[model samples]
Target: MSEPLLLEARGVGKSFPGVRALQDMHIELRRGEVLALVGENGAGKSTLMKLLSGIYTPDEGEFFLDGEPLRATGPRHALELGISIIHQEFNLMPDLTVAQNIFIGREPRTGRVFLGERALEAKAAELIDRLHLPLDPKERVGELTVAKQQMVEIAKALSYEPRVLIMDEPTAALNDAEVRVLHDLIRRFRTPDTGVIYISHRMDELKAITDRITVIRDGRYVDTLDTEGTTMPEVISRMVGREIAAGLGPEGVREDREVVLSVRGLTTKDLLRDVSFELREGEILGFAGLMGAGRTEVARALVGADPVESGTVELRGQPVRITTPAEAAKHRIGYLSEDRKHLGLLLEQDVNANIGLSSIRERFQQWGFVRDRAMRARSREIVDTLRIRTPSVDQTAKFLSGGNQQKVVIGKWLVKDCDILIFDEPTRGIDVGAKEEIYRLLNELAAQGKSIIMISSELPEVLRMSHRVVVMSEGRVTGQLDAAEATQESVMHLATLRPETEAVS
Candidate 1:
């Protein structure tokens, strides 16, 4: 007969204060298969993963592993029972080395008295080598890039050698190449005795790697579909309970608009070199490139977060020297960083505090005193405008989903009324439905005469949202194309254009 299911959850229900996080949720994972779980942000995806990982005890229902009832008291217990989870947000200790972070609690020891640093590092090195990861075991985690840190998280989860693996938005920080490596590793991990539950909002990836797609909506199970038999549009419709239009891109060119900001010969000490571009009023300018192509560095340099070696920035034909983010703010330029958790949002604060933060001194302060009532009123208005899924403005920022947290950051800049906005990977870890909302919001802002510079690694996003696309390669502007001229093939060609080829051209 057929083999038993690898993992299953039945009638699962969970509730929190003022939130019915999940109710009547169910899923089944067959042996040797990759099952993709998809839904909009705050649709009980992470909540279910937490329940499976022993981070939370379900108020009702049961979980079965290998046809046996499975109950875990805590995360450690769950790991001991052959279940491991990699959360979306990182849990690495920044001060520690890679090896230490990977095997923190379980370290080799000499007779249980002294820690074996070399042995620990050697073990980590072997794992990294086996996974084809470019990482140094002795390197400090805080010194590593966000992409590398994500790799470390994957390594840590795999170190447990669990029978069932659950990964939540595992590729949010990864590029195309890194994603390939991760997919290969996942393939190697899958066996007849093991199964995987892959949770992500990247529909393309779900098609590439998963065997079955299970959709959940509003904290409840929707339907499962065979990957080969389903279309992405159908899956999305099931996810959001409606039909969404396809091929949504820039409406038209903005060539006739006035140039509001111009950069010439932009260079940084590390990577950026001779980057130049112009952003028009009420235009959406896109920055596109491969990983390490210095796209993020351009945004950082423009905002004065990174020191620029040589460059000239002009606002409406007048040159301006901005040496700090405060100066950029003075010029009404707001930068929303890609690393939103660490750089964009104040996780410890509430939604109101985060939304009102950038405008406090100018809009919510009087006579050296903070105005709480006015701030709350304005924060509520932004909350409604952005449709941030928070119970109240007083809810902690950390408690919101990744998409809502991103919206909170956007709301911060909107409250400041910045005329020039830079969004760096604005939809990095957000779901499809939320991405649509963010896209709509961006178009709305541009129509309101706010200039936007959108830096994204996703080529489709750049092609869809940009009025003019600027392609960068090895820290230099390789080419600029209007919406009509920018295609996947054309953009990729310029993205791979090297300095030698650029000089030749």
Candidate 2:
């Protein structure tokens, strides 16, 4: 007989202001199998997970654990009931050690009031060791790399010994090697005692790791499929509700391009070691690297989001000091950060305000006063131009779908008329359909003579979108590849190739 369902979300429904995020969503995760929860960014996936985790109590429906109705009052209550989630955005105290972070509230005590550090580290080490994760339990989370921090999150979740473990975009920030570790752990956890709800936009992971796929669109359950019985094309089509023309073909490359953005000896905060590269007009140059390898750092430094210790940035053959994001904006350089919710958009603000923010003073200003009509008009144009699906331009960014929110960020740059665009993981939390949209936008921008520095963790994305690729390791550019010459093997080799000084990194 088949194993009993470990956890089930029964007719779940949830709503936010101006958004019906989830409705009548039903999903069953059976023991020993990994179930993929996938949909476009605003497809109610996050809302459903929140309901399952007790982060949000569903407006309707119920949850069942081992055929019993779960009465979880909050996230803590759910954790105690053996439901654990490793969030897409990490939720750890940076100042705390891995052991402390892992078993924060439930630390072992030496006496009535004192905690036993050794016992805590011992337990954390045991968990990390079991997973064969390369992480030091006693080390501070702040000192760890992004990939390592993700490992810590995994260890923390596993520490709960959860019957239902929910992983949201777990491998989003991990490299190929690091992803293998997670893959192995997933296989190891797929026993009669445990079930995993894996959420990700990456297609390959779903095919390899999941036993079944559950799709939700526009806050409603669409269908579910056995992994072995379906294909990605069909899966994507269902999630998007339309037939998508598959992948992009080789585009026309400029034979001879003029230099647009040039960085010489770009070193930053001891993370970036003598990083140097050049971008040509109408070129899509990709920055590929493992987490914390300084691809993001390089982009940040160029756009002055982070401090630059020593370097020279020349825009269109003119040396300029981009000391701040404002200065970068003045130079018409736009950076769409990988961490969009935190770094890119004002979540509480309306779409109109966000789209006009970067260009506030120049585009929608009049005599020290803002012109509301012009700003709204521009926002409406961009919303239509970018095909941003929203109720209206007045919709709060926090209420929009993840894919639409990302488009709002891009809209901000277009409003500013930015010539140099740096997109860091443009499609990180986006779905297959949205990913194609973003790719098409990038191609269109490059064709229109915009210089783009695309930073991505996905090798396939890098290969597909970029005309040239720069690979980084241990905060340094290890190698560069032409579009025709780059392969997964070649990129992975450079991406994992560490510098001698930072061998541990």
Candidate 3:
């Protein structure tokens, strides 16, 4: 009977206040197959994952594993059953070593209480070696790179000898090379007795790694297809329930403009080194590179979030010193960070409050009283402008969908009226619909004479939005190409160029 499949979820449903987050969601995972669950933000992808991982009990239906009824009250119970989940957010203790994190609870006890570090390291090393990971079990997990930390998470999952593994956007934070490494790991983990449920927004990765595609839409199961037979557009149509229009905005056509931002001989300790670039008004400049190629650091340094020990930032024609973010703002420079939850939004605040945060001080009266009416009007304008889908302006930013929260972040910068905006991974966790909206907004802003520096790890987004592309590698600009001249191959070549190999004038 085909072993009754590894796992079967039947008619799962869930709801939140005034929202049916998931409904009649049916999915199955067989041993030796990678089942990819795909949908846009607010399509109930996370809710379904939560249900599968035992973070939430289904309001209606039940799941079966190996033909036996399974009811897990919580994630711990599910983990004990050999169903492991790797969350989008890394859950790790900074002070703990790699071995400690992997064997967090079930540590080897030497006596009745003390941890057996040597034994834990031995076991962790075995798992790491099995994954062909270069991680040192003795090293502190906090000291490792994001990619390495992710590998450790995978090793920890393997330690449980998981029969089914659930991964949520596993490659969102990884670089191109790291993504390649992870793809290989996924293949190795696929066995006749194991299954993997992969969740990701990157369409290309879905085509590359997944075997079966199950698309969900608006909390409902749409359909499933064989990955080899289906196309990206078809999957997108299923998830969105409509023909997704080609990405927003006019393709990069304004290459003949004067420079708006010019950075020469830029250098920061460890973060940036001799980086230089020129950005033109009404043009979207894309910065592309692998993680640790200094993309975030460059954005932070450009917006004065980090101080530069050397280099000059010129606005229009004159040189300027951007010692702080405020100074950068004064120069009409704005930055949207990649770390949205921590650095981008005030989660506890309402959408209106966060939208007006950067300009709240400016909008206040003589006794430092906030002009509530004025702020609300401004927030409303931006909300409508961005087409942010929220219940109301009073809704907490945290309650909004990932894509809407991202719009709130953009609205904050728009309120600041900064002409030069630096967006670091603008569509990082956003859905396809929201991504198009953001792209359109960016295009409109540029058309209105705002210069933009967009730092993206996604090559397609970079290609689609930028007027010119600047490839950064190892803290330096390796090459710059006009949109017409840039291809994935050419851009990647420059993005992966080694710092030591850079030619000097």
Candidate 4:
């Protein structure tokens, strides 16, 4: 008989109030194979993983592990059955040591009252050594960098001797070098005893590490293709279920209009130095760089969130002194932060509330009397235009899906009617559908004469969406590429282009 699959799900299905999150989805993973689960945002990647990891029990379907039917009531039950999931966000306790985190609930015990610290450390050390990770068992979890923290989480999962491992967006925060490291680590897990399910938006990484590519669209099984021969364009086509046309590059854009914002001889302490650029009206300008390459710093300085030691920001050829966000807003400049959860919206508030958050005072009447109806109407207008999906205008922003929440934040800025907008990692956690929607909205805004600067880590998004791309490395602009001339290789080269200290000076 042929070897049974390591794990399999049959007719897996789930439903929310207004959406079918998973519809008759089916998948299988072999003992030694890495299966890549890919789809646009809201393609049910996370929902399916939650089913596999027991975070959410499937309302319909049967799961089999090692040829035996299995059901888990919770994550702990899944762990007991040799299944583990390492989420995108690290779940380490700040106060706990690496060893303590690894052995949290299942710590070794010498007796009923005595804790076996030495044994626990030894076990943690063994897992670390096996994984070839350079983490100190005694080190506090909070002190580690994002990559290191991810390593710790992986080590903790491996501590269970898991037969199945689910990794979600494992390289989202990693730089190129760090991504290389992660790719190497993932390769080591392709052993005869372990089956891994990898979920990511990055097609290149998926192609590199995964043995098989499974495409899902609208929570339904699309197809499973051989990763070695499948093209990215084909995969994206399957995920989106539509033929997406090429985007307008800088040459394709109408640049006859005057420059809306210009930065001359821009310098900031350590983080940004001698940065200079000109943004044209009705254009989408992109900043491409690896993490810590000073893109966010540049945005922060430009918007007066960070103080600049030198450089003048000129609006339509006239110098403007922007000392604060309020001042910048007065000049019709707005910034949408990358870290949206903390900086962009009031998570607990409703959609209407978040949309009107920035200009609440203005929408109110005299003597600080709030005009609730006017604010809701304005919020509704933005929501309808931007296609923000919420149960109601009063629906809490935090409860909406990642894509919808992002739209609400975008709506806030749109309602503000800023002429020059800076979007930093705008689609970080959003699904593919929402990403397309955001891209459409951006193009519409640019077509409507809004000058935009987009900072993105994904090179494809930068290449596909921007009219012009500017690459930064080590606090300096390395090269400028018209979108037509920009490819993944050219952009990567410039993104990694590190100039000498003297050149930067």
lDDT of 1 by residue, 134-194 (tens): 8999999999998899999999999999999999988866778888999999999999988
Model 2, span 314-383: residue lDDT tens: 9879999987899999989999998999999999999999999998898789999999999999999999
* lDDT per residue as tens, model 3, 1-505: 4568899989888987767898888998988999999875567888887887789988898898888887888988998887999887788887899999998988987669756688889988888888888799999988998788888887887788889999987876577788888889999999999999999766677778999999887889899999999877677657646531333323554547778888999999765888888888888989887656788999888887887899898998888888888888778788888998899899999999999988887764447788999899999999888999887889998999889999999999999999899999999877799898898989899999998999998776887798888887767788887776665655655654556565321
| Each prediction's whole-model lDDT (CA) | 0.88, 0.85, 0.83, 0.83
Q: Which pairs of residues collide in model 1?
A: none
- The TM-score of candidate 2 is 0.61
Ranking by TM-score: 4, 3, 2, 1
lDDT of 2: 0.85
Better of 1 and 4 by lDDT: 1
Better by lDDT, candidate 2 or 1: 1
Cα error, residue 431 of model 2, in Å, equals 21
Question: Of the candidates numbered 1 and 2, which has the greater TM-score value?
Answer: 2
Clashing pairs in 2: none
TM-score for each candidate, following the candidate numbering: 0.60, 0.61, 0.64, 0.69
Q: Where does candidate 4 have its weakest 10-residue lDDT segment?
A: 496-505
Candidate achieving the largest lDDT: 1
Give the per-residue Cα lDDT of candidate 4 at 179: 75
